[model samples]
Target: MISLHWLILSPLIIGTTAKLMPIKAAKKIMVLFQTALLAAVTMIFVEVRQNGPLLENIGSWPDTIGITLRADLLATAMVFLSCFLFLAMVIFVHNKNYADHLFFFLFLGLESLIIGIFLSNDVFNIFVLIEAATLIITILIMYKQASVSVYDGMMYFLINVVAMSFFLMGLGMLYKKIGVLDFYALEAALSQVNNPASLILPYAFMITAISLKAALMPLFSWLPKAHGTPSAPSVVSAILSGLYVKTGIYVFLRLQTTFAPLIDTSELFVILGFITAVVGFMLALAQTDIKLLLAYSTVSQIGVIMIGISLNNPAAYWGGLYHLMNHAIFKSTLFLTAGMIISEYKTRKISEIHGVYSHMPAVGVATILSILGIIGAPLFNGSISKFLIATGASGSWIESGLILINLGTIIVFMKYGQLLFGHSDKKEAANSDILEKAVVLTLSMLCFLGGIFGSDLIAILFNISLTINPLSYGEKMLLFVGSILLGLLIYRSLFKKRNPLAFIRSFELGFNEICLSITLFFAFMVVYLKITL
Candidate 1:
């Protein structure tokens, strides 16, 4: 009996009312609403898990005649994630100078759009939600206009508009051919087609849009700028890195399911996933800015998730989704801690900061725990996910490649780890709020517990029990330790010097060039479909 539309509509009304209220009252109301929303989402998640998907048509009409919304386990999980992250973020910014009424409004508006995207069953509805979210995000990235470059915000906005335009074109073709825009209907319609080749262009267009939003290779240039820009608040970065970016991957998975009977591009995505993972960490190695380092690391981790999802193995598929949630938790913790660190050190340069353990022990602990999770340390959330991914690639070269990627990840963190120690005398310890410390340290604990209970967590999330082979897990633990030692050696011998590949850190593609890449990528997908399908 839970109405799905209320989930999307309540936030907008709450946000607008909050904006008209006093700032202090606004923050209080926003947090309360977020907490309530989280509870509502949790109830829905449980119901969907217990029964099945909940579907509703607007105005009490039939599914084929009106806008439709459906929340299966996957969609509910994502919606649940969005609400949880927003709740954390609202609290994270509770005492900040920037936590104004307008800020609450913009933030809440984005949450509404994200939840709508997850629940909507209509492709056209999704397109509208994405386009609207894109605009809101543009405003947010430039919220503190004086601190960030106008160019960065404008660039992000333009790129998304152009990309989503392609999505619109694809939707047009889909509807023209089938006269239906619902994902379920389209899948059924496409299944009855005489030739799947006709769908190549539409698929390419939609995939291209999702790829850009997901920040896949060549399309990833926009991500580091948007997430790492100085003007973005830590909570905003957390939401973007932790929750917003996942929407793209969610859409990718959803659309793939829609097209499963007609085509399979798992092989292409697997190859691309590995490439993105490698290229991402390489770029991370070249960064001196701490925020940029973490931002690039996000790119690398996203690639790993994509790889797991793209694989044909069932365990790997679940592993990827599980990793997606793990990455959200740990990455958000790191960014929040980084924000406090920057505030304390008064610098963004990794070389200039030190002695975090001496200063803000809570933040340092959180940072290190997140670092461990990210590097796939033996008893961390990341290790569990990576182990499953590697297990799925058991006999292939990809397993070996994953090992190398793990090493690369450790190497990045080895440099990052230095931030946790040194003298704090030069700068006063970060006086983070009690609430902030509680939230961060709690998140860090979850990272550790997630590893210890990986199998149980997996079973709970997906309703499928996957047991880890003890012998394989032990072998991977040894590899993990070896990777740390090896990574340390590589960092000291090579990366300790002035970064020779700093150009990678500074690389930026122009709007025109990105447009060309879009064209090329579209053509590439078309050619790939022609040959494969």
Candidate 2:
């Protein structure tokens, strides 16, 4: 019970404390506070695992009128992951001079808001926390005060504000219809409601906002700019990719389940996931900037996870959840390593950087491991999750689509891997601090071990039982090898020359265009739901 309060308030308290302290002292206090918060969350996870969800109603109010905080397995797991990820990021940036008081305050505040998003059972509370998170993250993204990043931050802010406005209006509709905002109560009320169709407008409104937040197809224009901005801190990139985006996915999962009695738009999400995956990797393959390349890869991975969960198979759903954790590990490592590499080479272009294996062996090795995981190489975390997801796909078109997405992912990363070999004319001192190397290497090692013990890990974490057949290993290995070869050939023949898709790279959507896309998406979902019903 106290753990729930601590999870929500500790970070806020620490952030406020940091504001009152001197800069150097605040840095120390921030580190200590983060460490302590991680420890508290870990214990909470253990308790929740044993007791099965900790629930608290604020002010001892009844379920109908009170705000509820609930830490179920999913919520606790996310909180644990966010804590662990943020702690690693803090350590990674510890030796750097980026530890300004305001940075720590905003970062911690963001952490609190994210945890709040995960833990709150009230829909209105979730909306409030997400809005707060958006504000904090925007400040962090433009922390460097560069002109381009300032624009990026503003765009992110305004777009999200518009989305949240939709959410707020939807919440109003739900409250009017059901007279409650608690998820369980709302679900119960929705099940008892006579006209579920009447909820469709509110559902469409809320889901459209969530789709934008998750960076679904045609709504992801703001992601690359905010995530891959040159001026944004690497930890900021890591958090956005690793944790922030997942919050949207988390919300999507929860709300979809909560409103399941009214609508099940699982098929729509699956289709959108496929399109998003293809477009994401296609854009990733066309990128020259390494950070942008990684950012787009995140979009691709999110698409895959969305498909896995929406497939309505237990194995696929669990696999998607596992993939979520795996992605956080590998993607964070890649982003942080990319930051280190850019710092060393003084360039963001993949073509200009080479011989990383010779220059910084630790970063190089970490990058290689993360790449293997991202491309679903055998004995990496990605392979196990992908295999589980594919097992549930059962030779359907969804399976074929996933395979194609994998091939595209391979091509993009194959382009990215160019930095691992050959020589560069540029001479730069490649030195990374011990803490940074440790953090990257630690995450990389987790990626490897996660695959090696995938079955046990999944069972332990999610309590899902599954079997991996040794007989199928050879076939899986063969597929991976074939995909790599095909990716290499395609890259050499097409991408080796000038990128012909440069127009896609140069294209930018303005604010009005993005809002139009959001409107179109919502209208389409409503129409589809109406037709299907």
Candidate 3:
């Protein structure tokens, strides 16, 4: 029987082998390995489904002493997503002059690390995998030479290293407190620990570290720079923005559930999410650079995911997970397509690239559909998940916040759509690459069909009978149309400036510095008030 560790090791072995082979041969071998790795992941998924989560005990050690490899539903879903994006990226960049050997090795190594991070049940193991993933991302960012690449890679490296430091510190604290580095052991210790305040220092540090890497607000200063700086191949852009960031949310979900009692901080997540959603859109509205705009949108969309997690309801959990998957699909497709646009036009300014449709009709159509999907247009993949999120917030104060963010999403995408339709009558040379067309169309089709059949697909995964009743449908459609109209009005009336918005952008750059300074002061005052009362 092939153990789950095999999934993590396959890519490492291939990458090491590539170091010893000719570049051409290495590329071929790595590609073959990725295909086989994908098959192995799928088989693990099947095993998990037929049995329960398949977990591997390392080195014949007792279950209590050994690191365990796990393949739960969430991990399997991420693996599947990684495979899809990997294959798409391979095709998308086939003609580009990458260090074929280096590119495939790094790409496969990154995929393997990603799966390892998702599948590891041991806390120490998670730390190791995270470090490996971070290193790969750094290399990926700096692989090609450009000033922006250097700048972004430096920022990413600094922030993540600091984040990892905090993560390690937290792990050490937990291990000291519990005498074990497993999730189960930590949970047991947490239940016995008095004074939740003792855990806050570590929690705050760990969460902040992950937040910086994940590009959560007020720690999102490095995001637009990092994601925008890499002259990303389309597929790389997709995976970075769509899939990589979600790993933080995954950690948030796992740890928050395990340490629920110690966390008297659910409301903090809601408030932070509100700030992120608003700040992200405001920043997005201010950007003329199309890729930067998408980067800001990533910040906003992640806020929606955080909101669902904070809601603390099963429906919210399901909705958040569903939206996470859907976001990965459509957002990645959009970014990949956007990459193709940049390659063809040699510009990142949306305003300057008028009439792309005249030459690349497939790209134009894909862009339109993807924009619609992100905006939660009816029957698109995004709508159902968006609706579920709102419904999950129904009859609560947060419902209003959800509506506000929904409107924000619409407006940002409306602005994006205008970019797509700009100069529809202008003509360009008819020189379109087949690979570009294939990737754009494939993603667009998924966006369209995913929305239409999302409920059915989600049902199958959960193994439950999901009914699409009129009440649910009507409620969703109403919110959808209302949000769209509201977004359009906001875009036309308030955000029509040619100059980009620098209001919140200014905050992100310096906000974290101020936040760190004042957090202790605030904590002191709160404690002071409690004592006096």
Per-prediction TM-score, please? 0.98, 0.97, 0.91
From the highest TM-score down, the ranking of the candidates is: 1, 2, 3
Q: What's model 2's lDDT at 463?
A: 59
How does model 1 fare in lDDT?
A: 0.88
Query: For model 2, which pairs clash?
Result: none
* Residue-by-residue lDDT tens digits, candidate 2, 1-533: 35586788898888787788887777677668778887888787778778798888889998868888999888888988998898898888887787777788888889989999999999999999998898998999899999989999998999999888988989999899888999999888888877778988899899999988898897888899889998899999999998899999999999999988878889889889999999999999889999999999999998999999999998889989999989999999999999999988989999899899888999999999999998999999999999888877877899889989999999899889999898856576577899999999999999999999999988767756888887676678799999989989988898877786666887788889888888888889789878887
Per-residue lDDT tens digits for candidate 1, residues 1-533, read 46999899889899999877888888888889999998998898889889999998999877766999998988988888788888888888889998788888889999999999999999999999999999898888888885464677888899889899999998899888889988888888878988889889999999998998998887888888888888688888888898899999999998998988888999999988898899999999999998899888999999999999999998788889999999999999999998888988889988888888778889988998998899988889999999999989989988999999989999898888888777665654467898788888988888999899999988877777898899999999999888888988889898887676687855678899888888788889999999999
Tens-place lDDT per residue, model 3, 442-493, is: 9888888877887787775554444556688787788778877777777787
Question: What is each predicted model's overall lDDT from 0 to 1?
Answer: 0.88, 0.89, 0.74
Candidate 3: the clashing residue pairs are 286-501, 380-451, 381-451
Clashes of 2: 0
Candidate 1 error regions (>4 Å): 425-427
lDDT of 1 at 301: 90
User: Rank by lDDT, descending?
Assistant: 2, 1, 3
lDDT, model 3 = 0.74
